[model samples]
Target: MLWVKSLHIIFVVAWFAGLFYLPRIFVNLAMETEAASRQRLLLMARKLFRFMTLLAVPAIVFGLWLFLGYGIGKGPGQGWMHAKLALVLVLIGYHHGCGVLLRKFERGVNTRSHVFYRWFNELPVLVLAAVVILVVVKPF
Candidate 1:
């Protein structure tokens, strides 16, 4: 169980590392004007999207092992766990959204400004905070 928990934390951190940086890459990608630089950024973002996406699978799997298998938050007064799960779902949606935007960037069809991506980049921070607080404090 301890090993599972440790692995869960490791993968979650790995996944969030990508979640945090991918949009920053988008910010740079949006701001970049040189054709060669844009292509380079495109390649970086594509590979990162793939790598980080692969990380998410183990992260989610370990998380499920902790939640459903270990029952970390299944007892009474676990409403906070429910909220945490909801946030996780939203975070997953955000991940998918990043992929969609990444595809747009790949095709040179991005519509949003760098500023929009800068703001978008802050989203996972908020989600991470809420999730950590819910897990650590269990504040329902």
Candidate 2:
């Protein structure tokens, strides 16, 4: 059980690392001027996004396992846990949104800009803060 929890934490941290870095990649990619440079940036962003998605699956599954196995629901009203869960879902939505936007980029749509990427980069940090607070403090 402790091992599972540790694995879950490790994978979650990896996933968050990817989440935080992916948007920074987007920001850099958005700033590239030359066509070849932009294409290279796009390829890097695509690969990073794909890796994040791959990491996300096990993170989510292990998180669920921890929640159920640890009997979080058996404790006092888990308002903080609920909040964290909601925020996580929002983060998942953001992940999928990035995927969609990346597909558009691959299709030569050019929808996102540096400003957009900068703003998007902040979201994971906020979500990660919220989740860490909720998990660590569990304040009602």
Candidate 3:
């Protein structure tokens, strides 16, 4: 069980690292104005997004297993587990949003700006931080 928990934590960290970095790549990609440059950026973004998605699956599965197998209940009112769950949902939304954006990019849409991506990138970081705090500190 402890090994499972450790693996879960490691995978979650790996997933978060990818999540945080992919958006930064998006920010740069959005800045490219030339067609060739944009295409290159799109390719990179696609690969990175795919990688992140792959990482996310195991992290989520392991996390669910940890939560269920370890008997860690959803936190009580105003509890840390509740906060973590909320942030996890937000992360899920962020992941889905990335998928939407990736699909749009693949379709040759060129509407998103670097500024937009930069701001968007901050969201996952914030949510990940909240999750880490909730898990580590268990603050209520």
Q: What residue runs in model 1 are displaced by over 4 Å at the alpha carbon?
A: none
lDDT of 2 by residue, 29-112 (tens): 777778898788788888888898988898888878878878763467788877888998998999998888778777777667
Worst 10 residues of 1 by lDDT: 103-112
Whose TM-score is higher: candidate 1's or candidate 3's?
1
Ranking of all predicted structures according to lDDT, beginning with the best and ending with the worst: 1, 2, 3
Q: Which regions of candidate 2 are displaced past 4 Å?
A: none
For model 3, the run of ten residues with the poorest summed lDDT: 70-79
lDDT of 3 at 86: 74
In model 3, what is the error at residue 16, expressed in angstroms? 1.3
Task: Indicate which candidate wins on lDDT.
Answer: 1
Model 3 Cα lDDT, one tens digit per residue, 4-103: 7888888888878878887787887677668888788788888888888888888888778877877674535447776677788888888888888878
In TM-score terms, candidate 2 sits at 0.92
Alpha-carbon lDDT of model 3: 0.79
**RMSD to the native, candidate 1?**
0.7
**Each prediction's RMSD to truth:** 0.7, 1.4, 1.9
TM-score of each: 0.97, 0.92, 0.89
How would you order the candidates by TM-score, starting with the best? 1, 2, 3
lDDT of 1 by residue, 60-134 (tens): 999899899989889899999999999999989999999999999988899899999999999999999999999
